[model samples]
Target: MASIEKLPMLAAGYEKLTAELRALRDERPLIVDAIEEARAHGDLSENAEYHSAKERQGQVEAAIADLEDRVSRAQIIDPTTLSGDKIIFGATVTLLDDDDKPVRYQIVGPYEADAKAGKISYNSPLGRALIGKRVGDEMEVSVPAGERFYAVEKIEFI
Candidate 1:
């Protein structure tokens, strides 16, 4: 038997997934209606509307299944409840680049990661390197752009 993989996420991330699942569920009825309306137009073989609706239905169902799986495995975590000197998931870390410029990032689950938003997945190269690091620790990570180095300046659970 294989063990189930758990997805760790913040409360907000879990809520976001559930909300999207609800929206997708709500869209199911509309998709069925669209299929019925397209079928009424006849000629299923060459009917563009029917084919398009069917493709959309497939995509939506696939998305719903993926979201459901992720939601089912979700382990909600609160950052504010965590406290430690070492970097860990849900830690908001501040690092100084080679130029001594400070960059802040919050370690989160893969689904909640948004680089532009300063949220990084715990599995990312940089995030992985930062894990278990304490203040003033230096680490290097290889990204698609190039190799980058950073020094841990601070870690907060907020």
Candidate 2:
């Protein structure tokens, strides 16, 4: 038997996925109604409404299945419950860039990653380098902008 891979995520991320799943499930009935109404318009061969509705149903079902899988494999983690000297998942880290500017980011799951919001996925290049690092530790990462260097300045659970 193949082992199931667990997806690590914060509680908030888990809740968000579940909420989205609920919304999609709720929309199922509406999609069904739309398909029925479209079918009543006759001639399925060239019916634009029917085709559109069917396409939407397919998209929604695919999304629902993907979300369901992610939710089912989710392993919710609370940052506040963690305490460590080295960086790890859920660790809010502050790094000093080559220019000495402090940049802060929280290592989170892929679904919760939002670079603009200072949340990075643990699997990200920078995030991966920062893992298991402590204060004053320097690391380099290659990004789309080019190679960059950073030094761990601080790590916090919250």
Candidate 3:
């Protein structure tokens, strides 16, 4: 089997995923009870409860597998430990758009990406453009709507 590539993420993101996986594992007993109850209902051919329970079990199994894979390939990086004056992964970059409006975004891993929360994935267009850039440096990023220019105003590890 091909080796799985490691995923880069901040310590917070890694901890969040770990907690979610733990919670899911804890729900295993409840899922078992659901399956047993469904089976006791009898008539498997027409049993909607049984089918639903089986589907839920499949979903749980899939989630567990996905979480396990991510955990196995995790390359956790603590932002607080990093000291950088330039834009890099896990750095919170403040930018000034063409309109001179300030916007802040944290460059994060794919799984931790939340545009609404100002966290962009490293593979995203804007994140790629910001990489290696320093404060006061202007860069053009290609978005789905087209190219947009941004000036780096500040870079922080937090």
* Model 1 lDDT per residue over 37-56, tens place: 99999889999999999999
| True lDDT of residue 13, candidate 3 | 87
> Which ranges of candidate 2 are over 4 A from the true structure?
none
The segments of candidate 1 whose C-alpha lies over 4 angstroms from its true place after superposition are none
Q: List TM-scores for all candidates, in order.
A: 0.98, 0.98, 0.92
lDDT of each: 0.96, 0.96, 0.90
Sorted on TM-score, best first, the list reads 2, 1, 3
Better of 1 and 3 by lDDT: 1
Report lDDT (Cα) of residue 28, candidate 3. 84
Clashes of 1: 0
lDDT of 3 by residue, 1-158 (tens): 99779999888889999998998898888888988998898888899888888888888889989998999899998777787777888999889998999999999999999999999999999998889999989988889989899999999986
For candidate 2, report its TM-score: 0.98
Between prediction 2 and prediction 3, which has the larger lDDT? 2
Question: What RMSD does model 2 have?
Answer: 0.6
